[model samples]
Target chain A: MSKEYVLKEVEFWDGAMASSQALRQAEVDIMAAYPITPSTPIIQNYADYLSNGYVDGEYIRTESEHAAMSACVAASAAGARVTTATSSQGFALMIEVLYQASGMRLPVVLNVANRALAAPLNVNGDHSDLYLGRDAGWINLCTFNQQEVYDMTLMSFKIGEHKNVRLPVMVHQDGFICSHTAQNVAPLQDDVARKFVGDFEAVDSLLDFARPVTYGAQTEEDWHFEHKAKQHKAIMDSINVIEDTFEEFEKLTGRKYNAVESYMMEDAEIAIVALGTTIESSIEAARQLREEGIKVGIVAPRVFRPFPYDKIADALKNVKAIGILDRSSPGGALGMLFNEVTAAIYTNDTKPVINNYIYGLGGRDTTIADLKQIAKEIQANADAGKLTTPVQQFSGLRGPKLSFFDMESSK
Target chain B: MLEIRWHSRAGQGAVTGAKGLGDIVSDTGKQVQAFAFYGSAKRGAAMSAYNRIDDKPILNHEKFMIPDYVLVLDPALAFIGNITANEKEDTKYIITTHLSKKELLEKLPNLDEKRVYTLDCMKISQETIGRAIPNTPMLGALMKVSGMFEIDYFKNAIIKVLSKFPQKIVDANLKAIQRAYEEVV
Candidate 1:
């Protein structure tokens, strides 16, 4: 039984504090983490809770993110509920172990403070790290603000630990924008939150003396392909469990969520598709534009993994044009969001004119004014019934209007 | 909607002050947001903190703002901090200075003297809290200028916020707050 704690009806908290509180309430068995910018506070607060007798858990001070993930894997395999947090470079270091954790079907919940990959050396918000892990075989949940960060983190444990979906989960929030911004948050009572998360049930525990289990076995070209196929199937099938979990969470806390969220799209002709904190700003721009008779809308994927193709397509099928905003640099190609969204809606009878927008790299501010401009440009494309600008453009970049790919020429 | 920007050094508790103000404002069942721009800044490095308060939930996450109130916690920042950047025509300034309002206005020719308020927060905090931390005094001055909360009600709420500290320290902070609240002009 968990101890009961009195909580205010509402309290002010940053995304990091909210995440740490959720982790504490879940009564995690262990947390092994390496301190990194923006994300350090999540584990730091959890460690403080452990020291102050508020939580009963082991806090491992790992030398590096690689060691941290390795420790989580070992502990989770030993039948303990494990978790951790990291950011840009640290997440880059853990990429190798991330595959191992998911391949082993260990349900370790990882909180990511999404940041830009360093080259010029910046510690700011971007989607580079989050996009880097899209192929790592984890259920990725994207949050728009501090409240969602808290809710998604608490629910990640339940979703990942479900018997039908025994896979790792990643909850991502934009660094600084969500992680460092303080706002009002309503939290559940400790006992209620604990009961909602439930206990971790170990299946085929390595520590079980009566029944032994083997992990990390090497199956060469003979069986590796079959194992990967099964993993993919599990991820695809886990959507059922995810929906059920979201429904149950809504019942408990009246805050409804969906795999794909659409705002003001009932009769919209132009839409902006984005993720992370940009969703909120885009929504604000959409509202402002609607008042000016611009018929704009916003679409975002709450579940970044498994793509939520059907929901996204249904929400966006009616729009005439779309501006897909990608915060990560595409290196030398159209943005990843552009590629995925195009694929999702390509099968529709009437496809919307989709354009790629690469913006907000390395923590550059994405203002409502900028989003409004993107929406207006998309509106122009909708009215013209053709490509009005390049297929890909860089927004908010200083000096020079850099763009590429001419749709008319390609056609 | 009301927006506020604080100009201060990193170690002077500007971030703490912003969060504290958010905490206080949130109790009224309104929406509030507080954040700071921390770009590898060391202690004593100049930085700014911001706040947004409104009746409806605030969804804007951009750092750019046309602030309604500009607060200067360090006197030097009044002249060198670009305090007037993105300020509105009616934006009010609350600055910490040992000099009179007229004296400080002469130093900052671009500012409208009528919209500026000044107090010696350093002197107030040192006399009452036995230190030079000016964040609490600045909050006191804000309370006095904005009239957001009655002095007694604000003090009681702040006491709860500072409950984790020793009673002696809490009492000293109250004195600093009260002194600045009465002294700012």
Candidate 2:
């Protein structure tokens, strides 16, 4: 499309330390980050930003993730906008303060580069990070690529800082896919981005320094439930704020994205579902099937935290079967996303036999062939009218096909 | 609508090239979507990405299974990933390799003729930037094949995108892109 923009090619792995330089272009005023596998860049980036006068706010090098988020609370509470990033373990560590920030109604934004939390010592992309913290009362949004990471980071400030949604928001990007992959992102012009975002000042309240009153007063259990109600109200009320933020972002960027994006499933019998980076490959598979008149579609989830049920179910209602693709290991259960899709689709009247496809685990590569195979299998299974367990596993090439651990650990 | 699929490994600059191409095309008033299909593969793993430009809003966000244009960043991966099968009947194959376009076509006996446009960005990259990264140089070849965007426009776009980097690196990249843009037929 002949529109006015610049493009260039860049490398993905410039070392973890190089990542912060990318974010520094945003002119981040305040940042708090703690080290975690693959996600160390968030903190590393902020550290580099600190040494130079690259950003204006306090760069807190906290000892722990809990402290990192606590510092963000302190900074954001004092009326200076703040940013912090974390991964699986770090995300788990920051969980407590996550509730604290949301409950206090601080408009702090956190970028979650999702990774697997493990006894296996994994440092790859997975949903475990975001899923573990799903109920923590934060706006969770996933970006499929590095460009979206930058765009979402810029957009989050506007969304979180919005007057209507004074709750915290978590912008989630895949750990290695977007965080590590170097691509030719058209980093927004700083002045233009700032102008589009406008200036952010703390919503003045009675707690203004001139007036002098403390917020987040300890609530007694007798009325603590009611105090929690206000926070819940903010979470529910944020849907509108999130929508308005996206509307404004679309206006500024001329690129539109929704909480859920659908591709060519209309009048189709089977649907292949996914989110983030996996959408690209799945669409290719869908195109192949389309040419064969196999009739397939895809629904990529954009917002997993609020769990956009209405959007997902309404989109898939016409389909006869849906294949759910998840990038993370569900362990004994199923892929985290597959479980969520099933929960969303379980109640429909004209029900489709949804086949949950678990794949791309341990940071493995999922290709169009893998997706195409799953699409065909799911279609056949649905046509035969016999599918069970809500998940049809499509595993990649097992180097040795042996279960190495094999109950030896139990002994 | 021009649907181009770029095949490269995860750490390669294919996705960036895709986005840059989309950015350049947008300058010509077309709607475009630049996205990558990545696996859990680490940095050295093979990956496929894409760029689509059209006169209208693109509803087909899926990778162009039948791509009008195919950019093979690492020629070796053309076989490993079976990228050859994704090529359409009359698709343009702009590959980065040491072999000439004719030589490259002969190498892939199963692949068709006429649509083939092979380039050795490896040679061009070494001559210009002194590095093996042929992303910008291959981008020049893509510009030549498509006529979707001008070489000068892409050169300007490269300077703007890489302007944030050091002057030496910026100039090297500019030279690499310029050489490919001008030399590729």
TM-score of each: 0.99, 0.69
Q: How high is the lDDT of residue A395 in model 2? A: 57
Minimum summed lDDT over a 10-residue window in model 2 chain A is located at: A1-10
Which digits, one per residue and each the tens of the lDDT, describe model 1 over residues A169-247?
Answer: 9999999999999998999989889999998899779999899999899999999999999999999988888889899
- Model 2: residues >4 Å from true position, as ranges? A1-28, A35-55, A182-192, A203-207, A213-220, A388-394, A397-411, B1-185
Q: Candidate 2 on B50-140: residue-level lDDT in tens?
A: 7766776443433335788888888787556576665566888777777766676677776645476777777777777777777888888
- Candidate number achieving the greatest lDDT relative to the actual structure: 1
**Local accuracy of candidate 2 as per-residue lDDT tens digits, A9-88:** 32222123223543454455678767776677777767765675555656778899999999888778877677788888
> Residue A409 of candidate 2: its Cα lDDT?
22
| Native A-B contact fraction in model 2 | 0.03
lDDT of 1 by residue, B51-135 (tens): 9999999999999999988989998999889999998888989999999988888877788544899998889888988888999
Model 2, chain B only, scores a TM-score of 0.88
Candidate 2 residue-wise lDDT at A81: 74
**Candidate 2 at residue A251, lDDT?**
85
Compared with the real two-chain complex, what DockQ does model 2 have? 0.09
- What DockQ, between 0 and 1, does each candidate earn? 0.87, 0.09
